[model samples]
Target: MKIYRRGVKLDLSIAVVVMFLLLLHMTGMMYKRELHQLFNEEVNISKRGFRRFRSSEIVDKEDETSKVPSEVAEGPAGTKTDHIPAYNMFHQRITKDAMYEPSAFYIFNLLDELATGEISNVSLFPGGSQIKFKIHFKNGNVAIAKPKRHDRGRYWAYDQSEPFWLDNERHNAEIASFHLDRILNFRRVPPCVGRIVNFRKEILPNTKDEEILSTLYINNGNFCFIGNCVPWFCNDNNPICSEGDFMEMSLCVLVYPSVEHPFQDRPFPWSQGIVESEIWKERNICTEMLVDPEITMGRFFLDLMDLAVFDHLIQNYDRHHFTIVVRFNVESFVVIVDNGKGFGNPWKDDTSFLAPIYQCCRIRNSTYQTLLDLSTDGSKLGNLLRLSLSQDPLAPVITEIFFATLERRLGQVLREIDKCIENYGNGEVLVDKVVVI
Candidate 1:
């Protein structure tokens, strides 16, 4: 009787072990199925041909590196990750000195005040082909000013599809970009404002650059001056003239504290090339960027994807180069500058501007969510932009045609995201789970 009882107990124990193993297998299958439903399909490891670690999985041991906020590290007790890696990356870098970081409102107000103030000093801002002036205010503030080059209602007649069209930077675009950046909740652009200043009184009198002074002249009773000639087009033949005494221009605020934050200008991977073989449109350059040793170590890939989205919305195709802030031994923060090239042609929708999106097939979840929130009836992107730009000194910065194009382009972006989600699962497309450690 004892032997029979032992045999029964052994059989019961074996059955329980089998059931437990089966439950684990079933759970994994269910989890995978759910993930697929959330996305488009289960991402095949073999298809990608490489193993990519999630941002959460890429651990950083150094204390100097930007710390992930507590809210991001540990969300509501049982919830999944709720923090966006891309947004957090930018936020952390900018707000490292939260005690001193100026609010958007403060910056905007200060910029306006400075614009109205006297020009204590003025000099030629070197490097760019176009003529830019570095103006100093009596309050020790400085700004870079770009004179109004083109009228608002005009559109470039060149073929945007070629990607190498001759385009002039517009002052209105510079001001509008700042407003648009704020509306998109990505305050990457520096504070900018438009003001009509007297060329003879405020600017030419304070001018320090010999080249700038040499170009100044008078035409038809109005103050006129040809800027330094560029290799391509700008010359005495086409000079920017003021209406009598006043010249309209956009002033971009320059705010660099005493602390020296190192900035490096890196060439865009998909930069336009004159040579046919160097064209990036025909290739999946994102795959190359992903495998790069430096890019893989930090959140560079995610930043590029975010930039692609931002540039696409504004129809900026001249992202030939970008500046990255190297701090804490990582290349994380991307400083957005040179926005004058955008908003040139509203009718042309350049799909090539979205190479990072379609080629990489990845996007930050926070960016996607914010885009959806702004796309609604009451909070449409166009209305928000229109309202924001109206507050500027130079109201009606952009035309109604440009506003309509922005809304249309936004729809196209959302559709592209939907297509990506349909093709790949949510697990594959939405890569915002990455946390900067």
Candidate 2:
């Protein structure tokens, strides 16, 4: 009886040990599964790029014990997915009296903050008549700030004196151009704003004198004096000094957002010198190239046409090259940058610059409709431009005469469109929709 009892006890002990081992294995598997699920929730593969799963989606699938909240996942709804429709992301129909978009307003606010924020770094661009400084803000945002040189009469290679009306107010021109581009529903131009900032004294030691004059172009009227001729200048110092030796001279600057992955240096078929040669133009090689199954040239042509129309409206003829953004080096889209050369003269109309649109005879449907509407009633468009530009820190940068000139340019554009319709018919002259992606 004693031996049987000992055997039963040993068997029971073995059974308990086996159960404990099984439980440990199960717990480990559960822990690993939870980790895998969390990782999946944190990263999602989208057509545009890797986007994080929305907090709601993550929380819905996650265990109750998870720490992340649904509210923490909030971001721009348009950016939630990787595959964004080109038209939906880039195009917005604008009316004559259209107000600024909330997104645009938000950007303007951010730009204001960054401009006022503490400067972390400043570096001068290598070459240019109007010196451009790469400024880094404490908020981790980067901007290219071009100081006001119009009053001082600085000219770049592309800028000619005859376009004297441009006034070299490149900074103001930039902001005005951005507003006009927005009005035209072309989301190519980067958000630009006029900012008055004082340069830090620390930057002076690093920047060259020539670079300072070329880029900053501080004048007697704009500079601050220290003790009867000892100039004490810094980015944030007041232009007028009462007692303090330090004085800050305000620089009228145009701040443009910095893009991370620009195909600025990359060469495309259209960028080849031979392609731009007169021989190629005479032969019309560019137009003759049929659309490839892999890459559609129609989208490129459409974007080019849009850009040309925009340049004509502003009288900017210095678009020698354009920047592009690409995904996986396969799909690419144009990014409009360096538009300070626009708005040359309010009195002059450059019909030659509209050649692309006239020759192509294809405009976006929404753009065409907006132009037609504006042609009928331009007061609203003028009002919208005034309102849009008046919000800039430097008010009245764009005058009423400028708005009138814009209307005249718009009328010319309409005439060109009508001519195209007469020649090619509406079906061919107007592209219903053309998206790059």
CA lDDT scores, all candidates in order: 0.61, 0.47
User: By summed lDDT, which 10 consecutive residues of candidate 2 come out lowest?
Assistant: 1-10
Using TM-score, give the best candidate's number. 1
RMSD of 1: 20.5
- Candidate 2 residue spans exceeding 4 A from truth: 1-105, 127-129, 152-169, 200-261, 265-286, 289-298, 328-330, 433-437
Candidate 2 whole-model C-alpha lDDT, 0 to 1 = 0.47
Write one digit per residue (lDDT tens) for candidate 1, span 1-437.
Answer: 00000011223333333233223222444333433322222221111011211112222222322234521122232333233222222223353212112232134334444446557788877767677878876544567888887788767754754343467778888889887776666666766878778777777777777776777788987787776758553686778788877778888865442235545677777655445326576677766767676655655667677777778877775677766655424544556778887887788887777777887778888778878876776567786676556545566788877878888888888888888999997878888634322
Q: How many pairs of residues in model 1 come into backbone collision?
A: 4
Best by lDDT: 1
Regions more than 4 Å wrong, model 1 = 1-93, 96-103, 160-165, 257-262, 276-278, 326-331, 433-437
lDDT score for residue 100 of model 2 = 23
Clashes of each: 4, 9
Local accuracy of candidate 2 as per-residue lDDT tens digits, 152-238? 123334336343222333666777876677666565565565555543343444444453434343444344212111222223232
